[model samples]
Target chain A: MPTFADRLAEAVRQKGPLCVGIDPRWESLPKAIRDPLRDELPEERAAIGYFEFGRKVLELVRPFSGVVKPQAAFFEQIGPNGMEMLQLLLREARLLGFVTVLDAKRGDIASTATAYADAAFAGCTVDGDSFPVWDADALTVNPYLGRDAVEPFLTAAKKADRGTFVLVRTSNPGAGLFQDLVCNGQPVYRHVAAEVANWNAPTRGACGLGDVGAVVGATHPKELAELRAAMPDVWLLVPGYGAQGGTAADVKVAYRPDGLGAIVNSSRGVTFPFHPDDPDWEAKIVAAAQKAAAELKP
Target chain B: MPTFADRLAEAVRQKGPLCVGIDPRWESLPKAIRDPLRDELPEERAAIGYFEFGRKVLELVRPFSGVVKPQAAFFEQIGPNGMEMLQLLLREARLLGFVTVLDAKRGDIASTATAYADAAFAGCTVDGDSFPVWDADALTVNPYLGRDAVEPFLTAAKKADRGTFVLVRTSNPGAGLFQDLVCNGQPVYRHVAAEVANWNAPTRGACGLGDVGAVVGATHPKELAELRAAMPDVWLLVPGYGAQGGTAADVKVAYRPDGLGAIVNSSRGVTFPFHPDDPDWEAKIVAAAQKAAAELKP
Candidate 1:
């Protein structure tokens, strides 16, 4: 099996840098998807709707994007059954050859961190028998708890030949509250980026990128470019490209000359481009994903 | 129902501030718990073992503690089945009159953040019908994403009459990697602590503490005291009480003069004091909880 970095690089080469995010919202889901499950229990209705919509979105976006990220929060809001739905969607996404990144943004301390990592990558072992959980190719990790918290995820990922993207400069407008605090001479996000670069140093794959990546938002073009120069060997997972007000031109600087250094993500802009009442929602999704792929092509 | 702050204040008043953390590990479970489920599939065995052990811990610690924190990572490691077990444990803990804190350390951007917050409190609404997910009385949130990210949690928690504990200064040895950087003449964590104070201001209850709280580790006694002074009106959820090397005396300063400001969490020290082979595991747990409760009483 290829390293996570190589697999991601190959994905970009085959289908451009577009990574469609499957962030389904119950209210935002097409009526067509929601109406069929109306008679079931609320949890069941939402879970099945999310799964069906996610599966359809996966099929529709397959031609335009080689990587898909399923946001874990939405499914989790529907309870345990929703988590089961998320598991099924992830399995289907993998079976369809998409490099799935579980966007759970998990972080903890020591052995606790190891538990979350094992769930995301290697699966759990019970009395010597192993069972896969999320089993994502990569996972989004929060870096707030510092080195010990983040290292477990990196170690687990490395052991499983998986990957992790650490949050650097997030796209949210309020992100600067703590992330931009000038620590020493540089902003805090820069410090996090430096650490990410250090973490990515030893795991470089044949494609010149490592399993450790940095999530630098497209909303921060200047900082994104600065981060690109600072971590030349790190793969950048650029979110906020479309719905969050980041344009293609804004994210173009995130990529290396070979065009394998970045994978731009578009969630609502690609998956929920139409209103819930729209009859042709599936077509709308296909068109949106196609447009995004074209615009984000490196 | 009273506000989350008042509820916590009442708990502390009745049973002191000892918050027993239910972090179940398969290998750490007593043979009695694991042996019964050995013939089941790996996921089932792990999930059932966690559920049974967690239920037992709740019953055993009921007299010594009024609060229980279920670490989501440990249960999540067992997959969706484990999540269901976590849900059951939370329900049982709540029913047993223990104030439940789901220590997921969840954080994200905008609606995504809202999605996570809703799962923690207020449940999810589908076609006007709401369904509870974790439904924890409180949740542990990561503050790295800044203002907008943390506010949704506070909002949802407030609406549901629940609570939140934002990570300010963690207990890990390498927590200072970013948390202790000199930002604007103060450490980064103090900045986070100040913000927590601000967010906690409007939510103050009769106890003079607020629903928005800060997580300050017992390991850093000096910083814990500093944060205690910094956020006088905010509740504190202190971890690293034992096993992680923070003595009872180290956490003494975390509480206010009135003894209503902090809830000290002890995971392994209270719940896993005995080896898996020990038939007296339950008694060890009771003794540990009793000792911890007696030492930590405000």
Candidate 2:
């Protein structure tokens, strides 16, 4: 099996580093999609609507992007039915030849973290029989729980030839509450960045990157450049592009000279470009994806 | 509706501070429970076994503990079927008159955070209809994303008369990697603890404790004592008892003079006391819960 780093590298090389995020909102979905599901049960309707729309989005954006990230929170909002849809959508994205990243931001310690990682990659084992769960190419994790906690996810991912993105510098306005605190003459995020660099070292692939990556928001271009320099061989999953006030130029610092080190994610900007009532929502998604792909070319 | 703080205070007063953590693993489940589900599909079998085992554990431990926390990662390992079982299990736990805490450790920013919070508390809303998702009394949150990320959860919980427990000094040994960093003459966790205290102030209930709580590990009794002094009005959910090697005496510092400030958690210690092949597993579980309840009494 190809290492997760090489798979991601090939995807970015073919698709120009644009990762279209699938963050479905019932209120933001096109009227045509929502109107038809009005008579079904609330969760059922939302699940069906999200799955149908997501499946369409996959098809529409496939020409412009090679990676699709489905935010777990949005699908989780609708409950079990929604989770079922999320599972199906992930499988669909994989079948469509897109590298799927389940952006769950999950974190914990020991066996608990292993459980979440298994669900994201290896699936469940019952009576020696294995069943696939999310089976995504990668998952997004939070690094607050420290070494032992984050190590479980990395171990599980390596066993399955998958990848993980650790949160270092988030894009939210108040993200500096703890991340920016100066410790030992360096900020907390820099420490986290240093750890990520160490973790990514042993897993370096032929693409000059590793299976363990760091999430550095595009909203902070300075930090992005710093982190890029700090973790030269680590892949970067950059959010905060487009809809979150980050421009193409701002995220330019994330890429290496080879254009293989970063993948810029645009969730609402590319996926929900159309108003809920827009009749041409599919075309709008296609156009937005095309624009993002062109603008994000490293 | 009574505020979550008051409700929790009432429960602790009635049943002491033992919070039973339901973290089911297929390999750890009793042979009797596992044998019956052998013919079902892997995920289905695991989900069914977890739900059945969880329901039994709830009934068994109800007389001993008023608060029951269901860890989301274990259930999620079984995929959507496991999540469905989790929802049913939460409903069952609530119906049995236990204060349910969903130990998801979720964190994100803006609407994404709201989506997770809404699922944990207010349920999902489609059009004008609302449907309950997890419906736990409180949900565990990771505060690494800072103010905006944590506030959405607080806001959602407040709207539903629910509560949240933020990770402060976690019980894991490697937790000090980032949480113990000294910044501005104090460790990072102390800053998080101060923020938790501030967040808990406005929502103080009649019992003097507030809806926003902090998770302080029992293993670090010294820090637990210090945090208890720092956040007088905030409730503490203390994990790392028993199986994690934290003695009852260690967690005693988490309490206030009135003994209403802390709820100590025991997962594998209380739930998986008996070996899988042990036919007397039920009795072992009962004895463990009974002993833990008595030992943990404030």
Candidate 3:
């Protein structure tokens, strides 16, 4: 199997570096998807709705995007059934030839961290055969617990030809409250970015990008540009495009001049382009994904 | 419904401040637990073993400890069946009158964060009847995502009379990489501690602790003491004891003079003290939990 970075680079060359996000919020989903849910249980119904919405998003965006980053929380909200739904969606992403990044932000230490890595990357094995529980091509990791917390993820990803994106500069409003704090004469995010760069060496691909990636939010263009240079070997998963108020121009700063280093993502803006009542929702979603893909071209 | 702090305080007063961690690693499990493998699959047997081990531990420790902190990653590794096992174990904790602090480390932004909160604290509502998912009394959160990622957790915790403990100065060896970085003349974890203090105001209890708490590792005694002083109203969930190399004296710093603040946790040291081949495993586990409880006594 090719390294995740190599596979990602090939995918990017085929489809512009757009990473469509599948974030299906229960209340915001189209009634068309929600109405036909089989289970009477709200969580079950909502889980079904989320799965179908994700399936549709995959179908629409597979032609235009290199990656599909599914936010874990949206599916996790509905409990076990939701997780079951998420597992299927992940397998679907692989089957459809799209790079799947499970945006779980999972972080821990020792055996616990190893368990998370196994679940997300190499997956759980039974007998001689292995089952891909998440089977994600890559994962978004939190570095708060430090290196030991993230090492298992890197080790597992490397072994499986997968990748991981460490959170560096997030796009949320309160992100600056902690990330901007000056640590060692520089911002905390910079330190995180530096570590991300160091971790990349273990699985650096022929494309000059490493399996270890960095999540640099498009909300802070200046920081994004700075981090881009700081972690040249790192692939940046740039969120905050579209609905998060980050424009395409803001996200462009994260990409290299050669247009092969960053993946700009749009979730609600692409998946739920219309109100809940819209009749022609799927087409609009496809159109929105296309527009996002074109606009995000570096 | 009493506030989470109120309930926690009562539980602690009745059972002391020991928080036994449920870390069901496969290899370390007792021979008796793993020997009964009717299933052909390893993960299936491992999942069953983990669930049974958790059940036995809950039964043993419920009499001596106020809380049980189940490491989420261990259960998540076996797919949705493992999650179902975890859900059952969480329910078991509730039935046994122990406050469940799910060590999920889940953090995200906006509605995604809200979804995680609902899954952990508020419980997912389906068919007009709300279904408790993890339904933990409190959760351990990763603060690397900043305040917005943590806000929904606090809000839902407040609404549901639950609680959360945001990671401050972790006990891991590489925790200093970013956490101890001097930002704006103070460490990054200090800034995180300050924010935890701020978030606590929304759900302060009569005992003076708040629904929003801090996870200060036992390995970092000085920082734990400093963070304790910095956030007086915050409930601290201190991990990294025994098996993680932190002594009882190190964890003692997190407690208030009144003996009512921090909850010290012990995982492998308590849960898997005897070798996997030990015949009297239950007795050993009980003894370990007891010793840990006594050592962590305020």
Candidate 4:
């Protein structure tokens, strides 16, 4: 099996490093998609509409993108049945040869962290042929509790040849309130950037990049450049490119000169373009996403 | 509706601030409990055993404790069915008048954070009378993504009268690696501690305590005292008191003179006491927990 780094490198090389986000926002979907969530029983809503929409998303994005980042909260909001559907969607994506990054953003103490790593990466197998099809090639992790909290995910990723993207800097308006807070006159995010580089030291891939990565929001262009420079050997999962006011130019700082170090993500901008408007939403979205990906190409 | 601080205060007053953690270690259970997990199909091993063991645990401790900290990762590791069961168990514990602290430790950016808050406090209800019962009065949050990551929880918590415990000084050995790293000469956790105080400023309860809380591992006694002083208005969820090698004396720093500021947690120390050599596990374990509670009481 190709390591996640090798697979990501190959995909980025083939598809221009654009990673679409699958966030099935009920309010933003077309009438055809939104009706079921609004009208059906909760369980039926998850099993029928949610499942179909997620599957359609997988099918739609598979032909064009290098990877798909599925925001776990959107699926989890519908409860366990929604998660079951997520597993199905992940299996389908994997079968189609698309990398799935489970954007769970999970962080906890050691034991709990180990359990989450096990849950997300190694799904239980049922009958001789029935296996739990987990949808992620890598997971998004929070680095709050320090190195110990992150070590379990790193250990699991190493064992399974998977990957992790630790949140070093986010794109939200209030992100700076804490992340940019100066301690000893330097921003806290810089400290996190250094830690991300340190954690990935042991897991360097054949391309000299580590399986561990950092999530540096495109919203902070200057910080992205600084963080990129700080962690040269780490892969970057850059979010907040389109809807969050981050332009293609802003995201470019996240990439290396070779355009191989970063995977830029756009969630609501691509997944839910039809909210409160657009007569031909799906077509409009597909076109918009393709355009966005093109504009973002190195 | 009683505010989280008020409810927590009432529970503590009634139950002596003893917070029991429901961590179902499959290997430590009785033969009868272990039998089901061992004999069941691999797919059934975790979920069925989890629900059964979880229900038993709820029944056993419901009468004695003020709060139950159900480790979300344990149930989550068993898959969707386990999550569903965890929700059911949480509902059962609530009916028994025990506050539930779903130890999910989930943290993320804007919209994602809103979804998690909804899932934990104000659960989605398909029908008016029959809503999915969110089994937690409080939640453990990760503060890595800045204040924005935690703001959604605080918003929902204020509205719902729930509470959140942000990770501060942890019990793990490697906690100091990053959390203790000095930025401007003070440890990173000190910065987080001040934020906890800031976020809790407006939601002060009748007891003059705020719903926003901090998770200060009891193992770091001196740091706990410093953190306690830093966030005077915030409630403290002190873990590592028993199984993780923290003593009751070490945890006392988390409490106020009025005994209104903290809840000490003991997971493995109280739950899985029958480790082959220990005689009279249940009685001994119960006695130890009671003793620890008494020792910490003001």
Task: Give the best candidate by DockQ.
Answer: 2
Error of 3 at A215 (Å): 0.6
Q: Candidate 2: list runs displaced more than 4 Å.
A: none
What C-alpha lDDT values do all the predictions have?
A: 0.94, 0.95, 0.86, 0.79
Please provide, for model 4 over A97-133, each residue's C-alpha lDDT reduced to its tens digit, 9 standing for 90 to 100: 8888998998777878887887778654432323353
Per-prediction interface RMSD?
A: 0.7, 0.5, 1.7, 3.1
Candidate ordering by lDDT (highest first):
2, 1, 3, 4
Residue pairs in steric clash, candidate 2?
A: none
- TM-score list, all predictions: 0.99, 0.99, 0.97, 0.94
DockQ for each candidate? 0.90, 0.92, 0.69, 0.53
Order the candidate numbers by TM-score, best to worst: 2, 1, 3, 4
**How large is the C-alpha RMSD of every model relative to the true structure?**
0.8, 0.7, 1.6, 2.6
Clashing pairs in 4: A183-B183, A183-B184, A184-B183, A184-B184
lDDT of 4 by residue, B1-298 (tens): 8889889999898887778888875555555655645667665675676677667666665545788898988777667777777888888888888888988888887878887887788865443422353637998998877787889989988777799999888888778866876766678889888888989899898988989999999888999999888898889998888878888778888888888798988887767767634556556556656665667676
Which rank order by DockQ, best down to worst?
Answer: 2, 1, 3, 4
- DockQ for candidate 1, please give it: 0.90
lDDT of 3 at B279: 94
lDDT by residue (tens digit), candidate 1, A1-298: 8899999999999999999998998899999888879799998899999999999999999999999999999888888998999999999999999999999999999999999999999999887788889999999999999999999999999999999999999999999999999977999999999999999999999999999999999998999999999999999999999999999999999999998899999999999999999999999999999999998877
Residue A255 lDDT (model 2): 91
lDDT of 3 by residue, A209-267 (tens): 88999998898889989999898889999999898999988888877777789998888
Cα lDDT of model 2 by residue, B1-298, tens digit: 8899999999999989999999999999999999988888888899999999999999999899999999999999999999999999999999999999999999999999999999999999999899999999999999999999999999999999999999999999999999999999999999999999999999998999999999999999999999999999999999999999999999999988898999999999999998999999999999999999999888
